[model samples]
Target: MSLALDIFTVVMVVAGLFFFYAGSIGMLRFPTVESRLHALTKADNLSVGFIALGVMPQMAEATDALKLLLAWALILFSSAAASQLIAIAARRNRRRDP
Candidate 1:
């Protein structure tokens, strides 16, 4: 069970990194700020979330697992809020300029 879990966790981390890469590429190549924001927000949320969730299972103790979960929650909340703020800012800028 532990071995399988380890493999799964590794895979999740790798997937997260893949998302990060995709987001980076999209941000670089996309023509518009809104399109880039879409890639950045979606990819970052999924990548960080999956990676954090994977860490919870690999923790050595229940307390550690709880801590990991809490950390993950905090990250999720902050990232979501930040993304919203960025989106709002983008919209405001677009309205002002367009």
Candidate 2:
């Protein structure tokens, strides 16, 4: 049981890290601001969720796990809001420039 939990944690964490790496690559490789923002937000959001889930099993207490999940939820909301704002600004700028 312990080994299974450990393996699950490791797999989730690795998946999260992979998404983070992919997001970074997208940020660098994407040609347009909208595309880059889309990639980054999507990947990062998933990465955070995965990492939070991975860490939850390692927590010693239920409250601790709940707290971690709450944090992840907050991050999701904030990131979504932030990404929307950025996208709006990018669109506005594009309109103004052209």
Best model per lDDT: 2
What C-alpha lDDT do the candidate models reach, one value each? 0.84, 0.94
Listed in order, each prediction's TM-score against the native is 0.80, 0.96
Q: For residues 29-53, write the lDDT of model 1, one tens digit per residue.
A: 9998778878887898788877887
How far does residue 68 in candidate 1 sit from its true spot (Å)?
A: 1.9
Worst 10 residues of 2 by lDDT: 32-41
Runs in model 1 lying further than 4 Å from the true structure: none
Per-residue lDDT of 34-94 in model 2, one digit per residue for the tens?
Answer: 8998889999999999999998999999999999999999998999899899999989998
Best by TM-score: 2
**Could you tell me the lDDT of residue 10 within candidate 1?**
94
Instruction: Enumerate residue pairs that collide in model 1.
Output: none
Off by over 4 Å in 2: none
